[model samples]
Target: MHKYFTIFKDSYYGYFNYLWSEITTFHWENYFYGLIVVSLLVWGLEILFPWRKNQKIFRKDFWLDTFYMFFNFFLLNLIVLIFLSNATAQLFNDFLGLINLQLSDFQIVNLNALPYGLGLLVFFLVTDFVQWNTHILLHRVPFLWNFHKLHHSVTEMGFAAHLRYHWMEPIVYKSILYIPLAIIGGFDVEAVAIVHFSALTIGHLNHANLGWDYGILKYIFNNPKMHIWHHVKELPENTEYGINYGISLSVWDYIFNTHHVPYDGRDIELGFEDDHEFPLEFTDQIIYPVKKKRSKSA
Candidate 1:
């Protein structure tokens, strides 16, 4: 009994240590402050320069999304990322060993050896491509759609809506990207930090209800209007599945023929077309993906 208790204690303490280390190493302070400032800035802009003039400042289900933003950033994301990162790293190592191969054997160029700016550019491009593909899969795959549908359930859009995703999302998306990043192994911490910061900013902007078009550059970078169409209940004629899966760069959507923007204007009627009985409460939303229901295209 004493030996069993000792083992339990060690296991508990080890898991706690790992969790603490991950939280401390993740630069939470940066994201905490950045999110606060970004939220306030985007919220202010949306209020002052409203895109949908009829939309309310305090729209329905507003507080639920506020809870989502806090839940993801403070709890769910940190846990999922840390756990997934560790698991993926172990699985990757084992798979490589089983294949009798090494990452060094696949090396073409050392991206880290390049100049700082260029290195960051390469890292960003690689990770962004992985993310874009993952976002597409989340929509296309039937099983994955359940987890992703929570984000689309938002009828009223706002900056906080960007972080409103099912808890499993980051786990799958980041784990898939981890394989490539681990294999390449040249990206510096600073380059990754820049990529994450940029992604966070772009994500918030894409979800914001502000009224600024990016002109010709909208073809390259994702903006509010283009992304808003992504959540629209209606789609352009002849398209069945969702469009605008690009996370940061609109170029991917353009290249893949998934690019969609209304010639008329942004669609105000956003969310799944058939979501008449979707849950509004935060706890209900959290359990939504598990509930038995016929899935429909968003």
Candidate 2:
């Protein structure tokens, strides 16, 4: 009994300390500020020039998405950063030591060594490319598709809808992103902050109902119109794997021949075609990806 109790105590203290460290590391104030700023900006745009003019400001699942925005941004992301990213980084460090190749030596370009603006651009382009491929793999792999389907299950696109992803998703995304970016470490904390802010703005914008056509820039950046097609029920002819997988830059999609833009929004139905049985509640949705029985039956 004493042995078991000692083991339990050690485990409890370790977890508690880890949690406190992670909580402290997180920029709570900045996160809230960004959320509030982006929310107001996108909310204003949606109300002023909504793509589906008839859609209400507080559409169906609006509150649900609100909860998801908080849950994912606050809790899920914290877990990924604290646990998954740290573990991956440690493993990578060990691997580098074994190979006698340090991370600093392999860095393609150190953002700290470059001009601030140039560093920001390089980091943004590199990270976006990494994420672009990750997004594609999630779509192509059946097991990953089951988890990623939660994001696509959003019938109504809004700013908060950008955070509507499965909890497991951030773990995979952050892990994949950490290794490559860590080795390429010119991007200091400030550069990362700038890139993250840009990502937050563009991600919310793409998921927003705002009817910003963006004209020729649609080819340059992923816009509302182009991103909407990604959620459309059916894909265009000759496109099977999926289209518009680009998160920030549309150039990747264009280069890979996965870009699809319609002449006009005709029948823009969102969400999966056969997702009628998908869970409507937040708790159920959280567990949906991990429901082994359901996956087996499907």
Candidate 3:
């Protein structure tokens, strides 16, 4: 099964490579262009088609999100890539070798056999499943939730709120969950990068305040309209949690029975009941969860 899946994944990657080459001439500049285009599209959608009326973009949140965007792209990703690449390579090689399995032995099918967009879609779906489970675990386990709760304290939900996540998240999700997937030759570096970038962009889009009809697309993918509701203050209402797990598609949520679709335009309040006393400043946000835990213990 592992070998067969790897062959399938590689075949998809090969198709993506060929299609991307044909469409844009395969220049390094074109790769950067794709990145810029995606980023700009996300920004434009946030402004033009917001999900919630109350979750308007604020200057302070915008600056913080910008800081995190730069931090993750420039520092966190680079550091994780450097530190974990070799370790991941060894881990996967050892695991597969123990089972006498190798993905390279499988033959490649025709490069153009599969749709290139499907490759991007599958990449997002698989990674989002892993991320959603990781997120649930962080919340369930007390120690990890200490850091994760800082994210939930956001009073507003918008594109920037996606970046308001705890710093520990990238470490766990990218290093542990994503690296292993990449190591088995199931996904290439480019695909993995695309998944990360697309997930962040889509997650932010889902959190934005703009209103737009996703129509049939809402059933297939996550729209900001559905995701803003995830930030609702009420517990069970807030707990409509795992719907639209994918940054690009909602297939995983549908598969896992976590998908939710709202019918009405309801006014939902954001922020945690416990977080009312805490400050939203970076330093306070960082330390408050820890202090709260300590006080509970004492």
Best by TM-score: 2
TM-score winner between candidates 1 and 3? 1
TM-score for all models, in order of appearance? 0.85, 0.86, 0.68
TM-score of 3: 0.68
Give Cα-based local distance difference scores for all models. 0.77, 0.78, 0.59
Model 1, 1-298: lDDT tens per residue? 5644554555455656755675466454356665677788888888988787787898767777888887887566444555455555556666889999876766666788888788788788888889999998898887888778899998888888999998889888877886677555667666666787788888888888776558999888888888988898877787677988889999999998998776634446888867777777778777777773434333
lDDT tens digits, residue span 135-210, model 2 = 9989898888888888999888888888888887877788788767766685566667778888888989998888
Q: How would you order the candidates by lDDT, starting with the best? A: 2, 1, 3
Supply the global lDDT for candidate 2.
0.78
lDDT value for candidate 3? 0.59
Measured over all alpha carbons after superposition, the RMSD of each candidate to the real structure, in angstroms, is: 4.5, 4.5, 8.3
Q: After superposition, how far is residue 280 of candidate 2 from its true place, in Å?
A: 1.1
lDDT of 3 at 47: 68
Give candidate 2's TM-score: 0.86
Candidate 1 residues lying further than 4 Å off, grouped into runs, are 1-29, 103-107, 293-298
Q: With candidate 2 superimposed using the best TM-score fit, by how many Å does residue 291's alpha carbon deviate from the native? A: 1.9
Per candidate, the number of residue pairs that clash is: 0, 2, 9
RMSD of 3: 8.3
